[model samples]
Structure formats: C-alpha cells, structure tokens
Target chain A: MTPASLDLRPLFPAIVVAVTGLAVLLAQAFTPKGGRAPAAALSLAGLAGALVAVVVIAGGRGRGAVLATSVAADDFALFFQALILAIGIVAVLLSTSYLRETATDRGEYYALVLFAIVGMLGLVSALELVAVFVALEIMSVAVYALAGLQRDRPESQEAALKYFITGSFSSAFFLYGVALLYGLTGRTSLALIAQGLRAGGIAPAAAAAGVASAGAATALALVATALLLVGFGFKVASVPFHMWAPDAYEGAPTTVTALMAAGVKAAAFGAFLRVFLQALPSLAAHWQPAVAVLAIVTMIIGNLGALAQSNLKRMLAYSSVAHAGYLMTALVAAPGLGTEAILFYLVTYAAVNLGGFGAFAALTRSGREPVTLSDMAGLSERRPLLAAALTVFLVSLTGVPVSGGFVGKFYLFSAAVRAGYAHLAIIGMLMSVVSAYYYLRVVVAMYMEPPVGEDPWSRVGTGAALALTISTTVVLVLGVYPGPLMAWARAAAGSLR
Target chain B: MALFQAILCYVFGALALGAALVMVAQRNPTYSAFALIVTLVSLSAVFGLFGAPFIAALQIIVYAGAIMVLFLFVLMLLNVRTEVRAPGEGRVFKLVAIGLGALLVGEIGSVLVAARPALAGGFDASARQVARLLFDARYLYVFEATSILILASLVGAIALAKRDPSS
Candidate 1:
C-alpha cells in the first residue's frame, strides 16, 4: 500500500486508449460540416499504441500487483489485453465503411468504442471485485448506446432500451455477489478472498451483512457464486438469460453487432474465468454442478433457437450463445487445460464472429440491409469472394474440419471429458452437430439457391475488405497451425494467481 | 434495542421492495420517478439502521438528491406525455418474467435469512475512513476508474439522446 507501489506503467494500455477516445471527440468537434473526421483511423492507431504498451510493459516491475492489487498485469491479463485490443482494431476497421454506408458515422461511435476497449482491458486485468464491476459498467454503458446509434430506426431504439434494462439487472446481480463475498470474507481482492474462504476464517464483515458461522458462510458463498454466474451468463448470452440478445443483435447496425458478438463476449468470458478460477477454486465442488447444468441447457437451447431463425444476425446471436455453452464447459474443469482451451477458443471465436458479421454487413444495397436466407440466395454467383468468406465462417461455426472452431471445440470437449464431465463433452458434441444444420443452411442458400430479386449486392469497401482478410487469415492460420497461440494460452493459464 | 432495530430494518426493506414494485408497474414516467425516490430513501434508512451512516447519507445526497434532480430535469426537458399503455408481451414472455421474479424473491429471501446485518466493532466506515480508503489505498485505482465510467456514460448518453442535425 506504499505510495511507491502506485506505478502508472501497468495502466498505460487503458490510459492510452482513453486519451485516444478524447482525441477522437476533439477531432469530431473540429471537423467542418459535411466533412468526416478520421475517427475510425484514430481509433485504430490508439488501439495499436495500447497494443504496444501492453507488450512493452509485459514483464516490467510493479506489473504483478499494480496499485496494490486493485489490478494486475500478469500474463493472463496481458493475453486478454492483447486480444481485446486486436478485436477493437477489427471492429473499428469494420465500422469505417459500414457506418458511412448506414449514415451512422459519428465521432462518438469511435470514442465510445475506444472507451469500451478501455473497459475490456481493465476488466481482464482487475484483481479486485469493485474494479471489475466498474470496468464492466464502462463497457456495458458504451455498448448500450452503440446498439442504438441509428436514431432514426425504431428497432435500434428498442434494442438499446432492452439491452440497457437487462444489462442493469445483471450488473445489480453482480454487485450483490460482490457484496456477499465481501461480507463473507471481509475482503475484495480475489486472492485474499480465496485465502479467507480456505482458512474458514469468516472475518468480521462491514456493518451491513455478516456470516456468524461456518454453515452460514458456505450458504452465502453458494448464493454469491450463483448470482455471479447469472450476471456473467446474461453478459455472455447463455440460455434463459439470453432473451434480449437476439433482438439487440438483429436490431443494431451489423458492424456494431459484430463488436457485440466478438468484443463484448470476449471481455465477459475473460472476467468470468478470472473470478471463478481465482476466487472460488476452493468452492469448486459446490459450483461446478451449477456450471455444468448451465452449459448443458445453454448448448441445447442455443442451437435449437438458432435452428428456427432465418435472419442471419439472430442466428449468429444464438450461435454465439451456444459457443458460450462450450466455453462454460471449460470452466467446469478449472485450472488446467480447460483454462487454456477457453483462452484459445476465445481468440478463434472472436476472429470468426467478426468475420461472419463483416461478411453479413457487405449485403447492404441502397442503404438497405438484406439479412434473410432468401436474400443470400445465389450469392456465390454475384459476390463470389464475399460468399466464400461467409461460407468459411459458417463452416467454422459448425465446427467443420480445417477451421479454427473445429480445433477450439476439440480442446474444449476433450478438457471437459478429462475432468470427468464426459456428459458435458457428449452434450457439447451433440449440440455442435445440431448447430451444423442451421449454419450450413446459410451456405446452401449462398451456393445453391437463386436470388429472389434483381437487386445486386453492395461493393465491399476497403476497410471492411481489410478486416475480412485479417479475420479469415487468423481463422485459417489457427486452423492449420495453432501452436504459438496454444503456447501463449498455456502460459496465461499457468500465470493465474 | 436490538428488537427495535430488527423491526425497523424489516419495515424499511419492505418499503423499498414495495416502492420498487410500484415503480415498475407505474405507466406514467413522472410517477415512476417518484416511486424510485421512495425506494431510494427507504434503502437509505435501511442502511442507517445497519450502522453505515456514511453510505446512508450518500444514498440520499447522491441518488435521491443530485441524480433525481437530473432525472426530473430530463423529464421536463423532453416534455413527455403519458402514453396509453399497450398490452404486455406474449404469454410466454410474461410467464418467464413472472417465474424470474419469483426466483429473485427467493434469492433475496435466502440471502436475508442466511446473512444477518450486525454491527461489527472492528471496522470504521465513518466518512474519514471511507475517504482515506478511496484516496490512499488500493481503492484509489477503483475510484479513478469510475471517472472513466462516468465519462463514457456521458458521451454515450449524448450520442443516444441527441437529435439529428438534419432532422
């Protein structure tokens, strides 16, 4: 708690992004009417600078327990920070042309994106519960606004309202969980809470709530764990808590939906892993069954829901929910290859979802977004390359061979099986098979069916083309050779305190 | 004295819950805002009974005082009318909401029974100690982070609420 320990280096990544956000706001303000500021480019450069900051300070002093353990810059943190920054880069790239096409290109769009990245970086690195909550709020509030950026659209407004209300409820659940844990252990730091829980020393809590006995402590811990799970479940769009996701995803601008599916989910899973693995490892026996049940229902319900959707965005939203199920299975097998699998799966998932949404965005013609399967008919004959890109992403979502999703699911299910949750692996595999039916339906539409009308697809813009290339390259590279990323994931899993 | 404190806690807790329910059910935006104030004040009183007078005062000063003023100002600025209420969502959605509400009630019930509020002698939650924690301790990082959260929300609110120039 010494003043000397209050170093700012560990926070450079977030600060750099925040400052860039302000710069974006200024750039927007100074631009002449009818002229666009380089808001998207500014966001990309800021993310690049933050990426460099994450690398330069990776092993620096005061990184392990920055600001006396409110946050940490450990390997686990650096890994997610780099991944989140990369996701931000692609999101900005995708938004450049997509936003302009939809006439939603505003400076606040980039600024809010940069701020959300700041939140994601902090969420992954925070060691204390309060810091995590604050970071989560920063991310969610920005995204809620982004969801409704097209003010002229009623659907967009509805999306924003639904997301904000449901998001606030989830945040309350999380805050209550934090309060319960602090009451049970008289601590906020994850490591100290684990220590207190392990020692069976329920410290004298603050004035509001306290546990008087061991039994009471255990009850409180279980309830807190459930509440935390619900909070994260809502964020990741798990089944039963995913009611708002389809509407929000379908209503928002497609590029923003891409960021929601990719960046927001990645940030949630990162904190979800840290909290469960770091603070509640000792209570594994009590919470593991709950997570297992959630994974099962999420996978079953998510894939089935997606099977019923013809709209591309709603289908992807449900598919994202199903992927959350697969990721939670890794949580069931804590502190081992399961941890590594999640980190690795998150990367591939982000790349694929961004690529999928990017391709979906390219369907804009005359400012109208064509989103149905019928609209995608004979896409291979029209925009052959775009159709091919969407095909690969869909194949990846289906867990087909020579795709990143295949490898990621392999590791996830294998880890689940290894942890004696063979039922989880079995259900996961069955669900992936079920998912193929809906995912490939898009492919069949693109390749086999005929276009419904004479309307042609929009040309792929430069920014979107670059983002697609990056995502496609990453997906293919991970599919063919995932050794480097796997090693990084292993090191990160090892560094969890 | 302990009996009196427990009774007061229940009363305030019930008031908070009832007011929250009323806020949700209110069709008028202005009436909903008033109900929210009732809930916030009841919760503040409950906090006072728990010996956390600092937080109790903060609940009133920040939420009931400053934030409520902003809410009312926005309502007035919008010059909103009380629209006719539409029927609820589909039957399934309504059923799900009711089920979730019951579950939430059960959660709160169990939490209340399992973890009771008692005055701990060791902790100092007075304004001075709270300030030191926010200013000088690990919480300094958290306190600073909230500014970023607030700034992001400010920008977000403007983005969402502003009228289009062309319109």
Candidate 2:
C-alpha cells in the first residue's frame, strides 16, 4: 500500500475504545473471576493501543482528517485522546484493587469504564455542537451510573442523584446555547460560525430592539456564550456554579473521582478551547471581562471555601475549582498566549491531579471510605512511598518546584502577564498562595500527626501504587524538562487558527 | 411555505421555552418531570423546524419518549416526592439564582443584538437542503462522525443500564 493508503493507523484510537468497550461487555457476560484478569489486561492493552495510535497519528502530521466537519482527527484531537486514554487507564488500575476488596469486582465494572472512555474520546474529538452534546451526554450518563456503581452505599446513590440533576440542568444550557448559536449563525460548525461573524453583515435595526428583542446579533452571541460558559463551568467546577462538585466528589468512589478530576476536566477544557477559541474569537471584547470576573470569583471562592472543609475529597473538590479559575485565566488570555499555555496547563493538571487522586485511592480500607483529613494522619510514617507520592502530587498542586503543576501554573501566569492582564496574573498568584496552604496542610497531617488507630498502608495495591508513582514521576519530569511537551502543545494550539 | 415554516419554528420554540419555564417554576418534582417531557417534545419539534428531520425524530423518540420516561420511571421508583417536600436548597440561594438568571438573560440578549448582523441568509433553506449539503463530498466526513457518536451513545447507554453483578 502507498503511504497515503497505509495511513489508516491514526483512526485506531477511537476504534480501540469501541472494541474494548465491547470486549469488556462480553467479559462481563462470559468471564469468571479468574477470567476477570483477562478483562483488565484487555482494557490496558486497548488503552495502550489507543495512546500509541494517538502518538503515531500526531507524528504523521497532515495525514489525519476531520471525519466530517464535526470531528477533527488531527494532532489536537490526538493530544486530548491520549490524555483521556491515560486517565482511563489510571482509573481502571486504581479500581482493580478497590473493587476486589469490596467484592464489587465484576466484568461489567471494567466494561462501564471502557464505555466512559469511549464517551470521553468522542467528546475530545467532536467538532460540531450536536456531536459535542451527544458525546457529553454519553459521558455524563456513564459516569452517573459509575457514581452509583457502589450500590451498597447510600452515599453513592445520593451522589449519582445530585450529579444527574445538575448534569441534566447543564445539558439543558448547553443545548439551548447550541440552538441560540445556530439561530445566530445558521451553522453548527465553529469554523463556519467564526467566518460568519467576521463577515459582519448584521443589520443595524436588530441592535435597536429591547433587551429581549435587542435584535443586536451581539446580544444573542453574548447569551450563547454565557449559556455555553455556564454548561462548561459546571463541568469544570468553577465558582458560583460549583455547589454540586464537593458533595458529588465526596460521595462517589475514589477511582471515579480520579476519572472526573482528570478525564472530565480535560475533556471539558478541550471543548471549551475548541468552541471559544475557534468560534468566538471575534467576540473577545464582549466576553473577556466576564471571564476575568469569573476567574477571580472562582479562585477566591474555591480556596476560601476549602478552608472550612474537613472532608479531604470535598477540599480537593474546592481546590479543583480553584484550579479551574487559574485555567480560566489562561483561557481568557488565550488571545495573547496563542493557545499553547492552555493546552500545556491541561496536560500538566491531568498528570498532577490524577496522581493525587490515585494515591488517595490506594489508601482506602475495605468497606471504609477515605473522607476525613484526620483519617490520613501519620501516613508518612506508615507508608512512606505512597506518602511521598501523595506529597509530590500535593506540592505539584501547590505549584512547587519540580512538579507538573508548577510548570503549568508558570505558563498560565506568564501567558496572562504577556497578554498584559498583569492584574489577573497577580490575583491568580495570590490564590495559588492561598491554595498552597490546604495542600501543604495535607502533607502536615501525613507527617506530623499520630497514626489513626491502624495504618491503612497494607491495603494499597500494586496497580494503584504504580499509577501514583508513574503520575508523580511524570509530573516531576515534565516540570523539570517541559520543552518536548511545550513544542507539541504549541503545534496543536497553532493548528486551531 | 415561508409563513408556515416561520409559524412552525415559533410555535415549537415557544412551546419548548414555556415547558422549560414550568420545569423550573413547578415546586412538585412530579410536576416538574411532566413539564420536562413537554419541554423535550417541544425541543424535538424545534429541531425538526431547523430542518434536521432525522435528528428531530430521534430527539423525540430517544430523549422525549424514552429517556425522559426512563428518568420519570426512576424518579417514581425512588418514591422521593414525599421525602423531598421542602425546597431542595435555601431560599436565599434560590433568589440569588433567579437574579443571576435575569442578568444572564440580559447579557444573552445583548450578544444576540451584536450577532444579528451576520445572521442574514444563515437559515435561508430547510433541513433537507442542509442534509443535501451534508452529503456532498466536502461535507461527507461530518455525516460519518455523527454516526460514530450515535453508536458510542448506544454503547454508553447499555453500559450504564447494566445491573451490578455483585449485587
């Protein structure tokens, strides 16, 4: 076959997920406990296959094409595809031990996880409004079920309920925004929408109408932007729209939380980057100030709210919100940073956050959930390696040296500074300082306090431990030498225009 | 044909908006579920008006007829209506949410005004015309992508609805 004909490889990542999803379902039906190992192995193999496919497709630039106007199977898609697959793999690894301990281990559990990964990959790659919405629904539905996967726990049902209610609400907003934007541009394609806006042939009479009738095309555009932002804000747990996150995160299984923090956050940001940066660039003047305000509120509210939280998951939920603010700052400054900074921050954020959650996942006792800060006391003494891994993750979250979080924050702040939003950068820096206190406090609890009755160290699994170690190692390595990552991020971001 | 199309779009859009308003305003969870069904149905019609006949049909068949029914069935199965008699959250928060809603509406209105100039000829033709446009060589990729999304959704739904084996 010619090289062009041979280049059917890049599309395998999506196909791999589909195939694995089916295999997992089959395993659930036909496989026994001893056979369960094969399901896990198959999932890992599939995820690895997808990740390698992404790398190959990304390497063979210009070989990938948009499946239609609705999906771009290019470097940008591959970058996010790789992130989603990695997060999925880590989640699967973390859950193996947790599930085995609870006797909740089943083939369907892995299958559901594969399905969730399929949704996430679909979300990252989709380019059209309907496509994104469908992908999001698929992802949300699977996760809602996953949240309640622990059927024995009432909290799991509660978390699933709350998430479903809020998620449906957000979906409504997303759909409405899609409708409004379609009304405004008559096309669902972001590129076409942008082109139409740039052409700027709107009649002036439309501007003279009342607030509802403001017939001003910009009014509809602003409404659409606000609606879309609300939907994404809920997903990323930005302040004012983040009330559901803490409760949901606390109630859900730890492995699922890792997926939420890493896969969902990355996918949401991916969609946000694609929609706003590609379609609404011309409306920057209208939306920038609003985003700046949101960034500040999210940062302040997230950090301060986390202060009173005794629940570790809840605190981390709030911290995730705070981080969303920092990422939003990067997004707001996208005009100045040229998109590279936002993409880089997402990658680093995924590594560090997933690492922290994975570490937490390993420390759980059978039939006992990890919720309280006090529950983790003296962890450094009992399980030094896991503690060290968690510490590294926490430090990375606090933007400490030699961690991916540090590099991500540095790029975000620098991007804002370069964008001449010096004030926003300063605010972001101050919030990071506030954030450091909570992350460090976790470290203090681990090292300084007496052990809680019995050490939970022996319960940690090799797979989960491996995930944490690899995540922490990647975070540190990326922090110290980010040139290679920065180059790819720049290339992907440049392709947006 | 133009007048009929305009009327159809308006009726569907209005019905959808009205149902959404009822869903938000209704205090009873059961009533809210009923309103949601109406809203979903209206939205499906709105999709039809936009010329996406297949998607519109799917919206009704899947979202309104099946998904909403499933949601209602779940809600009933939980039998939570009596347990959650009180408002779900604090009154002050609700008020603030309403205020934010107003501001959001105003902002969206402003954006609509700004964007109106470029909307000319955006919807000059019906959904069938658009579908024809979609099948053309240049637009073929999107058709395939949409199919993939549908397939993924099917898999996802099955995965989610499957029972816990350990139970």
**Deviation in angstroms for B39 in model 2?**
14
- Name the best candidate (by lDDT): 1
Q: Per-chain TM-score of chain B, candidate 1?
A: 0.71
Identify the leading candidate in terms of DockQ.
Answer: 1
Q: Which stretches of model 1 miss by more than 4 angstroms?
A: A59-65, A206-210, B1-60, B68-126
Error of 2 at B150 (Å): 6.5
Ten contiguous residues minimizing lDDT sum, candidate 2 chain A: A203-212
- Candidate 2 structure quality by residue, lDDT tens digits, B1-167: 98998898899889889989988788777888889988888888777776667777878889888888888898888886733545667988889999999999999988776555353345545557766776653345345545545554455445446675445
| C-alpha lDDT score of every prediction, in listed order | 0.89, 0.78
Give TM-score values for chain A, per-prediction: 0.97, 0.93
Q: How well does candidate 1 score on lDDT at residue A243? A: 95
Q: Give lDDT tens digits, candidate 1, residues A1-497.
A: 67775777668899999999999999989999878888888889999999988888776663464657788888898999999999999988888777767888788999999998899999999989999999999999999999999988898999999999999999999999999898888888999999988878477553245446788788888889899999999999988899999999998888889989998998999999999989998899988999899999999999999999988889998999899999999889877899999999999999999999988786675568868888889989888888888888888888888999899999999999999999999999999999999999899998999877785677888888989999988888899898999999999988884
- Model 1 has an lDDT value of 0.89
DockQ of each: 0.50, 0.18
